[model samples]
Target: MTKSTIKVAALSAAIVTALAGCNSDSGSNNVTERPTIAECKTYEPTQPVIVKGDNQDLNFQTITIGATGDMHGRIFAYDYALDDVDVNAGFTKISTLLHEERAQNDNFLMIDLGDTFQGNSAELFNPLPIHPVVETMNHMEYDVWVPGNHEFDFDRDFLFRNLEGFNGAVISSNIIWHENAVDCKNTGQETPFLRGYQIFDYNGAKVAVIGLTPSHVSSWNASNPDNFRNLDFKEEFESLENTVDEVIAQYQPDVVIGALHHGRSETHGVVGVNEIASKMADKFDVIFMGHEHARFIEQIDLGAAFENGMDDITVSGDKANQVEDKAKSGTYNWRNRDSKVKVIEPGNWGWALAKAEIDLFKDQDGNWKIYDTTLSNRTVADVEEDAALQSEMQHVHDKSVEVANEVIGKIVGNFTNTSNGGADEAVLEEQVLNSEGQRLYTTIHSAKVSDMPLTDLINQIQIMYVEEKGSEAIKEQIKVDVSAAALFSDASNLFNGDTYRRKDSANLYMYDNQLVAVNITGENLKAYMEWSYRYFNTYQYGDITVSFDPEVASFNYDIFDGDIEYVVDLSQEAGNRIEITSISGSDFDKTATYVLAINDYRFGSTMLVEGWVTEEDKIWDSSNETIYAIRDMLTEYVGLNDLYRTEFENVNWYIKQYGPSDAKGNVADEDKGEILQLREDGGEGQDLWERLQNKEICVMRSGPGARDSINVSVNVDNNNTWFVNPNASNPYEGCTYSNQPK
Candidate 1:
């Protein structure tokens, strides 16, 4: 039999053995599981009802809002191995926590902020009809949920299909869909599709929950905008303000809640937590924010209820601050307004729970008003896995393992891609030891250089895939000018001689970034390189150490491959790092247009590749109509090549030259001033090139670090992580680089 057939037979046999370990007694016989594909297909949409037992009572004074977001397919809890942090992230543990909270509090409501679907490497590649993750949510019993930007990671229909399996109230004020929202609005009945908002009767409290999705969902899947072009992510802040006013005038609820799939930030307005928080505090009593999977806890006091030139009467509450200590006592008639609210944003995954509890009292007039409140947004870590929940998910987990291990191809040899923050200990000890025999990583006086095969491999994969998407004439007209990728991990080492499994290919490339090819001019390409190299710090005349800004996310440290060679003069400022010397060993013409292959995320994400791409110039998008995820493409490439080998990689195209050489390496006095002048000018002359080639001034390579580049920072914590263009209003800053008509 051929290799592909033989491999499938082996995988099938292995799946039987792996699946045998699952809890057959529980998984196979659970009548409570969701319906079959046929039943789901023919089913009509219905609102998920609140399940009540004989002991369950609807009357309660305290109302708790349970929140979750960015589940990202983490159905089971696993060890994360962070040193200072405990990780208990998954739906199983979250299920137990949610269950316990319901019994303790009389009124408990749960909500999932967008990103409810997608993610989880195992089941994602070939998902079952009824997603097991959503089925698990059905068991946990959620009250409401809205789609996140990633919800569109698959086809638009796929999201609607998954929503079918979910047993929760669907509420999102900003998601404007073409098919479902109009019917739901006209009928005014609770349906499974879409709605502007939903009102809940929490005992005697009439609480309105407003759902909002990320506004940038449009650019998020730019490569595959065809699937979601019919829908639009409305301008949220203003839309939310209008919705709150309308909900008050119509429903006249005692309490209003803002639950969204948006992240919290220190900055105000647009993409800021404090900015949106100020607007929310005007009408909503409680808010749950998500998107960025980080820990946060804050009690934003937007002055007093009507203290900041506002009226409580707009929200059906008494106006003006009429009590001492409005925050603590809650005695003002405006207390019932959106004043003195609490916001929680439990971290992503099943890692933790975002929780809020509000105490509402019926005044002498019998109108519900807030008495007191408490809020907490943190992770629930180091907890025991819920055994029953674990059993329910056991079969799916086993199947994931079977699928993850399916061999796709074989590798020629083992390769190195150690992500030791570019500081190789062995390289340090042998090559970068101090004059006193100390490892340079710990010393401020050493420098090191490491090969970046991981980044190289990713670039190669993207380029190969981008080339295949078009014909020879099209490619010849717009050659892959350059391809971009990053060494996202420090320890992605691939084994040689072993068969490459589907999971191994995933490890080689994590994240579901699809391929995008766009046309960029030579001038814009230089600017793009300058933007990428901003992660590296400038060099000075000291006991130099090669260190990176931890604030700069590792994903931003992208390397490029093409028919060009450029030098990164680290001594320059953030916007002036690259010195493009040649295009195919000749002067680069500023007007030459070339095709640039990049992952869809970078091209569309606010934090990375947003500044350069022109929307109209998009040539070929791998996800235009279908999600040809880069990882899946890589797997295909490996299988087609028969042997996944890197020996064929040219390992050329670009180089990193330190700025010290431009200053004074082994240069004579006559050329010292000239070298410095050309370095600052970024000239393309041959004499300047000869001076840059010498390693005595600065190390140059297509790798991580070469000697000890200076003493680098070893302390990298999660809090220090930062993104590019975080403060821009339009993630792309309206900077569309190309112009191609639809």
Candidate 2:
């Protein structure tokens, strides 16, 4: 059958079943009868209600009313990480607010627009499953509840279980049951589910409340299909339109209110609510919106008649007020008269509460009319805590606190109980000293070097370089080269007095091992220097001069070659190899590869360093072990004569002659004295010893040349990695695995 035919057939079947059930009840005389007028008390409005005399001779006087808004509950379960204490406290607060409202508003009938369960820890562990939240709502005495999208989070069975004990009405106009009445009966008390909308009476006046949830729930629930299987949430406007018509015809009510669990219109715009409101403008009087957490108030009018293909005019603001005044003329004429509708929304998180009061009045003809509607929103503040409520909520709060405390301890150790700076330093020191320290075994992903006194080292290096150049001309050249390296490489040089820190392997404290700077021929050196200048040009630096032969060929990389290569000779032989005088390759590359100087994390291959792929590269352990090695070497070199101590004093002079320059072509001023002092003290230097014991030192040794060209290998077997390959079209080209291993 076609889809339309199937739908018609299903609808026909539903109508037949309903009619049959009604007939059976009528035949058995089982339906409850209504009371006669003589047995009921005369209806009277307990509050003032102003009315405008019009059709039906409706009297103008006091009328009973009900108002409710901002019933935000269980929304927390959807998207929050809270401990048990906070969750339970939240529920308790909701309960307290409900009770407070119940006591204050005599004619008030409480209703929730859904989203009560599923957000947080409380829902995760609620005993008796999905029903605990329902039980709490029951205790709060909800008059009616419309199921929201989250209501289906646990499946229909779980929903039914929790809703079983609820005394209030469960209403939804859009939900359609798959089974018949007979099937429902056969399924027993734990039947899969029930479907239909319900009507309730308030103060002798019949009021119909319809419920509709978002249609998107079908796809959103795909992750947990079993929970929402066999259920469908049709388009809300369509369902509401049909349901409102049927409801008005079956049980004429003075007011029609639609409770929906969809988001409000401020964000989605007036489309969704507008469509429902405009279509049912003549049908339903009010629409209660939920879902999106916002606040707004708007009106929709639908009584305008169509003329020639154009919509009828809608009167608003002063025009509407004038219309009401004109209606008081007692002409029973609706000509030039207009009606107004209001839409309101309140923000979420229990931060505010919305209050709306609708006053109904009877005209001279006894027909009911809306006198005046007042809306007021109040901020929740300085309210006294209900003692009894607090006691109940505290139980949940306490448990949550316990869980939070445990988790905090797990991540923070004893740091939580101590002072900040002092505690941080102490913990760091102890961790370095003890093998059980988290940092010792844990990988060091990055490092930050402080920028204070280090700039002085650059200045001294530059000055010393200029002095060594002899002639003023060569001195100028040396100054430029020294300035270039210092300016480009010195992250701290810019913005005078600014402190800098870097989280990388190339730092002074991390360089406890010996370093040997290889010398190149003047011609090749100029080329290398030019390349260095080019690389440094991309970075910023402080006052520093730098110059190089712009035309020379630096490294044997074809990628950087351009027209500039012809400006300088390329035949100059340059020594570009690093030789470790303190430790030979054999010393480190033993059968099992003995321990060598390197940072603790790199030794463990934490940052995924190249050449340290095998476990054997974890030779020297962390900086602590390397420091001990330095101490041992220094002690042996010093002997009883302390001859090495004198050599330490001259270390500064040696660095002044060969080290990278400062702005003045000398070794950095700040580091000059320290280098000498460290040399003199040897292993006995307090700073050196402290750094060693704290494992704050890093030791690294360089290799001959860029053999692999790649720094990091994506495929260990294929030897494919990233490197600054000058031969490639893209000099900084990254290599990928290509089946062959180099």
Candidate 3:
């Protein structure tokens, strides 16, 4: 074994010996004494030994810790998937900052909080003896390493190789090798997959860093078992506290840092970082977290109850509004709390570096204790990229960029013209203006308002995949009558003149989610559609834009295609919005069963959660077959069919009642010249009118919670609702009130 591998093995062995209660074998001359659970249970914190003539007055030392997480393969200052230059983030920028921080601080340590080995072009180099990202981390001399859930996205062997290659200690307190699992590490016996925690010596003081990965990886990757094959994750709270207790009992470090790969909020059974940090506040001093891809530095008051209940304690970066009774009452000062723990998360893709400068002082007894800590998230906006590091990884960067830009296929038609007389082939893409009048050229804006070729392409590919590669039962019995896919990104688009590239495919389907076909009744299907249509706000008089419910994510708004016709009437409330007219050229049946194609995330999180479907209802899955992920499947489809023929007729759904309709069920000529004139006068409702002409919805781009009070209330005059803008003192500020209209 190499030096790094040997170091990891030795360290891991010692950790396993201490935690697993492993006894000395018959071959051993002496009985090796290891800390038992009973002994650990009775253990107390260790006391320090004082040296004579050690002056307590001048015994202060400041330790600086710099951390980054969710790097996601951003080794260079570029997005390999988009083939776009990223000026904001990259490992080189982080390296420059780290180097600068190291020069300024007497005691400095670098840490990476994990999710390092996957995403972008990182996977392309996985087959290498040492992955470039891991090699880069090794070069940077990372002191403590935590493995996030995404670390298991690839094969177990690949993960192990990279971990073994990493020079730093791989510490994950919550993971253990399964009893029946084959030893992928090639060790003679089964042991903990990684060391629980690593203790670092800063000058004379010791700092213990405990690493925690999310426990919900198995649930997230239920469709793909091979990702985390031999590993089992323990409950975060129980495992973390136990490890902390053990660390304190064995070696009472001056400082304790939680390097967590979990978020602050409790989501989908994954324990929140705050829950552990709060309940175990006496031991922990500082915590660094990741996996939510957010950035923030907040001092959490320990053992304090949240004013709005447990679920209300959220610290989502950029959008956090944490309210606590203690905070409001002025009893929850960060430094004055019973135990103050500062939590910091550096935003994903190397956007910022989370720093904690902790000052410690030696007491009369020579016991080192924390005096104070300063936390900040330093942005990489103005930092110069490390040219040396970038130079070293240039070959990999070039290859990734080349792969991203490699043309797979071509699109011949714009797919916009359903009627033949229009310039379909000549039109590449029409530049449209948003409500703000900013010129935008994209497929997403139009796709969201009505059925478009982009989503239709996704739906068609899924249906074709099911028909071609599904199981015998699925193919013979249930036909894929309908398929649904979300317009995953606002950047996803297809231009008539442009060729399909790898980036194009990736942009179209941004996730690694597997395709799943579930059986559902027409009632459940309609219910699902209604739930999706709830993303839009209800229409009201003098309403300018089709706003979104801030609570709803756009990705959850699935659009259906294939042998189906439906209308989303924004005038109606959510539950009554979806009106499915027909399926398979027949009247919609509420009780009749039909197979629906959807991504695994939606199936697991929504379909299963809502009790609308079960595992038994699943007829086919891309994971069970040899089909690629939806993104790769898109590329494969493009490769097979070099030229896309946009005989695009799958405009199966549309919105209604948002604008006037004629006797022929089309947008009627406005007899109400006041409304037309009001729209023509510009501002507020002008863009909505322009969009109405194209059968599109004008989306409101206000930040979340900004539109909460924007609604329609029933008017007493004619049972018609008027617009209510929360920000406007006069509700109908710019527009004419309906009492004098028409």
Candidate 4:
């Protein structure tokens, strides 16, 4: 057979085990006859009578086992309680796999690696007091069920009441009862309910299966401290090893298996299944590990032992892979050979089912031993639907589908493309021109502008900032640059793309406006007249530069010269850290005011920009809202063709010519200047005020009797100010200088 054909054949053989048995039709019809405790204990297998002629004979013994994981029952299909068909289909598939295996082998055991309660709407939304998941698992009739960490999501009372109704054995070796507490009758703490080991006798062969759960229950469950208050979780490996030793010494079982909740790696390691397989290889003949959701079938050797006059090998393996290493030489060893013990994990949410077949043979000493084992997946797609289970889960499935189909919102435009072109001409440039004739290259994209409201944006920014940098870091950065004047200073011009290229979206540059300040002295004002000549010398931006005379005062600033006349000495100015000493009277306040021009990002008061709250004379609240409104207005006005336009008017060209010069006539290149003019509705300085005004602005007051002067304060007992005015007609206005004290 071809490799593909061989693989298909092996998979088919793994799911179904055919064992030859006598025609005991007498007990076949006794479905309702529950065997007594003594009768069930004494049940023994009868050897099949072989019809042999000459030297020909036919007899075979096989047992099939099925495993699965993560059945968070009682939970709705999803968070919204939609998509119940998928959930029902999953349960149906598991049920079908179970019955199929049982049909192939009379003695078949089905185990579930847990996580069967408390998730989604079913658990959260249901009006009924009892957990529906408990009823479903009980109906499935799992032979053995292990408790997962999430099983305790519900309080202990609910767990006890529901588990009491389950027909299967609920096992956990790590949970220890408290010395002073009275046993809860319905819980695993009750007698006979809590079993360290269960011995199953199949055809005169005894197989002992030990159960263990992770000791770190508190780490996963918040309610664990309350629910399992009377119980102590012991070390997993230590508890399992001790239990296995005791069981082996007492029962001398032919095979040992462990149902373990702990994975092999550190508490939080990747590929936890492999780690568990490696560490516990020497402990058990076969181990079924959970906690980590991974699928594999491999064998690891534990050691060699003499059983039934034959050298029996104890191998560690999973149901996904069939070969494992043996630790006969003190260290775990593995060979590329067929495996005996198979571990399997059917991933979360009943997405898949795992099946294994173990062949048992008797040795010369009449002791049974595992001869061989194989594992395979019976895809959920292949299993026929169980009508009863489907009927029960139909309502949930329909609800889930309905919720998934509804649309949340619409995308009116495409996302932004940030790729840089190879050639200069290949670059796309767009500019914005202020009414004063100042021009700035402004590229408006969807990432730069979106449909989300400005208020929502501000809320997100504030929440994100607080989450990333502690409240203290935010406070410090604000205190350092309140006016945000230094925010555009030379020190802030440092840019490192490599260090900033983080995968997180929060770390990316999100400002929508840029500020540019001009400081000209009377001595250099004449030289600065030639700024237009120097500006046009640089590479052409989106539009070609034009020359004009400097006849208009678009902005207000001081004209300083080497002569001290009219040159206000700002050396003693407390908050004049931006180096511009003689600011407009309207720009200064005895209350320590600031003028802030920012983009939608800054106006939203995103923690990404420091000092938004602490260091501004005045902020424009129209930041994010203005952008959204502009987009909407532009969409209507331009119909999405080109929502914005810019022209290099006369004043912009005149100012660009002189550029920025030093004392030695060393001219600074405008093109190389880190500061770039961002073109939005508000000009650089005015934009900050607009953003602040658009936001929920607040005015803060500090000092002993000054408390009532300000409208609102961000934090009490501090000089920090907040512009909590969301309805300001113009968020940014002239700063009012105050000399009066309360």
Top candidate (lDDT): 3
- Where in model 2 is the C-alpha error above 4 Å? 1-101, 178-196, 265-271, 303-338, 408-742
Candidate 2, 350-387: lDDT as tens digits: 33334445566665666565655544333332233345
User: How far in Å is the alpha carbon of 165 misplaced in model 4?
Assistant: 1.5
Off by over 4 Å in 3: 1-58, 179-192, 268-270, 274-282, 305-337, 415-444, 471-478, 523-542, 549-554, 569-577, 587-590, 605-611, 624-627, 643-648, 657-684, 687-742
**Each prediction's whole-model lDDT (CA):** 0.56, 0.34, 0.64, 0.37
Error of 3 at 545 (Å): 2.4
Measured on C-alpha atoms, candidate 3 has an lDDT of 0.64
In candidate 2, what residue range of length 10 has the lowest lDDT sum? 441-450
Which residue runs of candidate 4 sit more than 4 Å off their true CA positions? 1-60, 74-89, 125-130, 180-193, 268-283, 303-342, 382-384, 398-742
| Candidate numbers sorted by TM-score from highest down | 3, 1, 4, 2
Per-residue error (Å), model 2, residue 657: 45
TM-score of each: 0.71, 0.41, 0.74, 0.44
Judge candidate 2 at residue 72 and give its lDDT.
29
| Model 1 Cα lDDT, one tens digit per residue, 677-734 | 3444444333322322221112211111122122232111211211122223432221
